[model samples]
Target: MGYTIDPTIIRDRFARSTNEQLIDIAENEIRSLTPEALEFLLDELRKRNIETSQIAELEKKVTRQHNKNVSRAHSALAQDLSKEGMKLAVKMKLENASNSDIQEALQNTGISSEESLRIIGSLGEKAAAMNKTGNKNLRYGVIMLLLGCLRFFIIQSKDDLNETIILLLVLSGILFSIIGLKIKSDAKKISEILEQESLEAQ
Candidate 1:
């Protein structure tokens, strides 16, 4: 879905975020940023006059935190749905069944109303989580692209003993961009699988 967010709003939000919050975003939640939002983050860092070396260090500290969170969420979701339950749910979703119909179908299988409701709620939650993860991956991909470009410039400006560090940064950035795109694609697929009309609204 195409959308737009004001750059000033993004900048203001970043401006209000504390240094620790910014670092946390950089290290743990980079994937959650939009490309424009990530640019604003970089602008905020520049406004603070944070050194390139420090930025590089922050990049090095980045980990698979988002992956870990997604893994745990998926594990919980799996435990909530048996093979038969999952199949039934997917079938209903594919059939464009109403929330009430799906609920009734689930309850017909000896599941309680409460359990059926919980299952539906879990599906919504998982879809939302996957969507959020996809957004983050896109943001992280932008970050990688920006950092790779920056390193390429640095490599041209001066001869330094840190060639190995520069090479690693560039290579890792490329690798991350590729991986982020793949993760974003998977997240989109997961969202599609879990998408449904709101039961509450019905």
Candidate 2:
């Protein structure tokens, strides 16, 4: 029995064709054919010992190639964004973004080959804004720590015996300060990693 061109298979192969291939086919092969004539031609091709399986395999090959291109594009885009993010983070002195935040930013930027290069180019400003927000949060935490210490002093001045409160305040300040410095160091390390990754992607 001759093979039948299943409607589903036809649709799948058509979808699999690249834009350039589709344009070429439309312009050169099908330009003069009416809709009915095109259908007749396809039906004739289907009956002349062509296997749908071969068509499916060809479609899969095209799809694989397209996916590879997309993967490469995303890698390049991620690298660029990572570099940009690190530079802005350093400039803003925002040395304390969580790993989750860093990952999310990379994922949301949506860098891929199919998109125009200009779209990826616009993300530098956005990265700077995100880094600035991170810096502001870090500064706020520091201010809150200082204010807490000030409040402890006010209470101590009002009370006659406040040794425990004073000691707690001093120790807490020292601990928090150390933590803040460590956070700064961690951010620096992470930023360096990001820059390296960006370079590798290129």
Candidate 3:
């Protein structure tokens, strides 16, 4: 009845993250003795100005990335196990199952719904605690992408008399910008969380 830290678990955390979050994790958790690292980490997070919701998005992304990595590693391990004549049950029961699987198992086993809710709620609260700053970059990035698309469309339409194509391009750009901002916003939030944790630890 003992526990172990799976390197794959750590790798899964990385795989589920944006480059920024991965960097933050490295700065905060994996690295030590980097001069004034905690203070610098917090300052960097402050400069980024991420928000709680965005941070939640980051956590989701990291979780997702972590899951993907887990899946890949699990699959690889399964193949190795197969070569060694290990049973499927053994493979499936590994610690690297997806978070969804973990949650589903907890729910299916009649773990109280309230308890599950509390766990989920706590995760959100953790993210909020990590990043107090709201995400300005997310707002600005979206606006800029939209404007870029609009400008590109107007220029093209006037040059080629293709109003329909111009409109479509503008719409596409706006949509892409909105989506990109949302993704980046999540990454920003994740970075903030890592930074906050790093600062506190120091």
The residue-by-residue lDDT of candidate 1 on 1-202, one tens digit each, is 1113787877887799887777777766666655556656666766665667886666443334334546666777655664456457645755556667878988788666887777766655554564566567667656766765777676575556455556665676667667666655654554564443433445
Clashing pairs in 3: 12-66, 16-65, 16-66, 50-133
- What local distance difference test score does each model get? 0.63, 0.50, 0.46
Listed per candidate, the RMSD to the true structure in angstroms reads 22.6, 16.6, 23.4
Question: Can you list the residue pairs that collide in candidate 2?
Answer: none
TM-score of each: 0.34, 0.27, 0.27
- Measured by lDDT, the strongest candidate is 1
lDDT of 1 at 77: 65
Q: How high is the lDDT of residue 25 in model 1?
A: 75
- Considering summed lDDT, which 10 consecutive residues are worst modelled in model 1? 60-69
Q: What lDDT tens digits, residue by residue, belong to model 3 across residues 35-105?
A: 23323333334445467665455445444544565676677765563333222211222333333454455
Q: Which stretches of candidate 2 lie over 4 Å from their true place?
A: 1-160
TM-score of candidate 3 relative to the true fold: 0.27
